[model samples]
Target: MKRLILVTLTLICAAFTLHAQDTTQQIVPGRVNSASNQTRPYVIMISIDGFRYDYAEKYHAENLLRLSGAGVRALAMQPAFPSLTFPNHYSIITGLYPAHHGLVDNTFYDRKRKETYRVGDTVTVPDGSWYGGTPLWVLAEKQKMVSASYFWVGSEAAIQNIRPTYYFKYHEKTSNDQRIQQVVNWLKMPEETRPHLITFYFPEVDHAGHSFGPESEQVRAAVLQVDSAIGKMADAVSKLNLPVSFVIVSDHGMTNVDTQHTLSLPDTSIVKALKVAPGGEKVLLYGNNEEEISTAYKFLKQNENHYTAYLKQETPVRWHYGQEDIYNRIGDIILVAEPGYAFSFSKRAMHVGHHGFDNNLTDMNAIFMAWGPAFKENTRIATFENVNVYPLVARILGLDITQPIDGKLEVLESILK
Candidate 1:
């Protein structure tokens, strides 16, 4: 009897030890529990500023060609309204529209503060006031996953006191090579601590596109240089031999603007009738009396040949434009120039290329490409909006973003192996 009892005790002890070992093995080190227990895939999101779909299609960029050859490609990424950098980039990261995200415009005057907020300016980062929604990096951190960014708008913002695990101060002259090196070094860290989500931004293409038209050789050279840098990044990731995915996207494409098609603000009588000052491509008109507002609206509308005008609440619903919440951020009357024509604040100034047009313009459509683990090869998806990108990224990282997003988890059925 004593021997049988001892044997039973020994077997129970062994079973418990085996169970513990199984549990330990199941717990992936540094892995957070998302909705799905599947191991999170590493993701690198690279933004080539002002990269147009046609640029990649027409240009002889061997490196970018290699990426497209290896992974899934979207013909064009439709950007949200204004089609500017800050709002579009923010939408890509947050999966929300500018109206919902509260970025409203690239440069919006604040009536209460009596100041102008430029999206690129770090000084304008309010005390949790600048950003309207949670960025993906912050959302990832909340789920106990690590994220890093090189330089993205609102990354410096003190909102929620959340900063990327690693970040560099935004510098206009930061070389493409330097940015690539920084990302590679971050990835070289041990698997347990390396960033699960990484973002790298290249601004030279946009700068060149703005300086010279999108079709100019200068922009083409910038695109090739950025493409080469992307190749270096992919090479480094390939060396890791881990199942990682890379995505290359852009904020907005560029359009050529001719001097003959320019409209000067000073030349318009509508400018003299406004209460508040105007800036950038859009004009802001403020009025205390109903008559002033009505007069301003009629003048701008009657001369539709000279301008594309929108009454404060009457802008197109498709663009998600002119919500009451964003009215203060927007002008009482908003104006956009027709294609080939750009609104110029000064007649003396000269800019060959520009964005910030309606979303319908093909030149305003951006680029999107994804390659590597769990992605389909040589596949092209139809048109997708910028907001859809965030959920796709979240799904890749195995994160559950609890907040409602404007974007949906797109049909990546072809990409999944």
Candidate 2:
């Protein structure tokens, strides 16, 4: 009994230490804005995770509505296919489809590396080697323009051997006020050192949507909470007299799935012959070889009910997955659930809200709003792909795109002043 208690205490202390590390700020030394870059405009890119395209209006997020109305708003922003959190957020920043960026899913198995990259895993989440593409911060730092991140996907990793000059490991314990003040403090730094590009993220809406479903009062409350915080942050930043632009976006939108009847694998006979990675809206199955994969694929298609089975090479072209997979991370077979259904093995109740669906669905669209000095007044635009945001931010901060990316600048160029 004493030994068990001691072990339990040790595990608790270890977990607490990890969380503490997440809260502390991480600053890379020996980086500063160049003399030329010091005069460049500033942009604060904010991502509200799982904020649906219509959330601001549906929930009456007055502050967001007001701010977006004054500058630029999109009818909606289309997330890349497999509209999951990590993939789409990375897609927004890198201007690459998930397959192009190599973060093809929130959790994907890389056959080449013989490893699985799962979100929220302490070891893999911060490992730079798993990531590809030059993130905005990496681009800025390469050009002697400093950048910072309050919280954003890939911000914690040192992609291309560079992390933002100022960043924090993600931890949800920090209050809204503290996060806002931290941004204000960073902006007030000397011009030579202040980050010209800042990335901020909010996870409240996503949390609420998952726990209580998109239509619940809890989601409304979360939307209001984020709206209130943004209003405060923008009001405080405006007082600084700096030319700042605010681009609000979400990684993906939420949908309420049919919870009463969750979708399960149609065939269990071949389970022993395959490896499986299960996501809420999709499942990936890997087989030992072509014959094994073919057999499993045939079996799944015959027994298909709520889900559709596709061989990896035959996934929708728009998803940029399957044959476009550069890292060979996609499984041999993928099972995508129908919109109203979710894939699960547990008999227990599934989460009512879910994403990770086909991005072309209207319900999967996310929000996009740009305001402040960088945007035209009272401008509203049509739906645009989220990938284009990378070039838009690059244009605002005067950074050049160093490599080939899927996003084209012309798609969103009209919104700028």
The numbered model that scores best in lDDT is: 2
lDDT of 1 by residue, 112-228 (tens): 665655543435643347677788888877787767787676665655677666765555455666667777776776655567888878887887877778888998898888888
* lDDT of all predictions: 0.70, 0.86
TM-score of 2: 0.95
TM-score of each: 0.85, 0.95
In model 1, the runs with Cα more than 4 Å from the true position are: 1-39, 112-114, 125-128, 266-270, 273-280, 324-327, 411-414
Poorest 10 consecutive residues by lDDT, candidate 2: 1-10
Q: Model 2, range 1-417, lDDT digits (tens) per residue?
A: 000001111111111123234588899998989999999999999999999999999999999999999999999999998888888889999999988898887777888887877776677778889888889999999999999999888888889889999999878788999999999999999999999999999988887887788999999999999999999999999999999999999988889999888887754667557877777788878888899889889989998888999999999887889989888888789999889898875555677888888888888999999998989999989998999999999999999999999999999999898
Clashing pairs in model 2, backbone N/Cα/C closer than 3 A: none
TM-score of model 1 (CA atoms):
0.85
Count of backbone clashes, every candidate in sequence: 0, 0
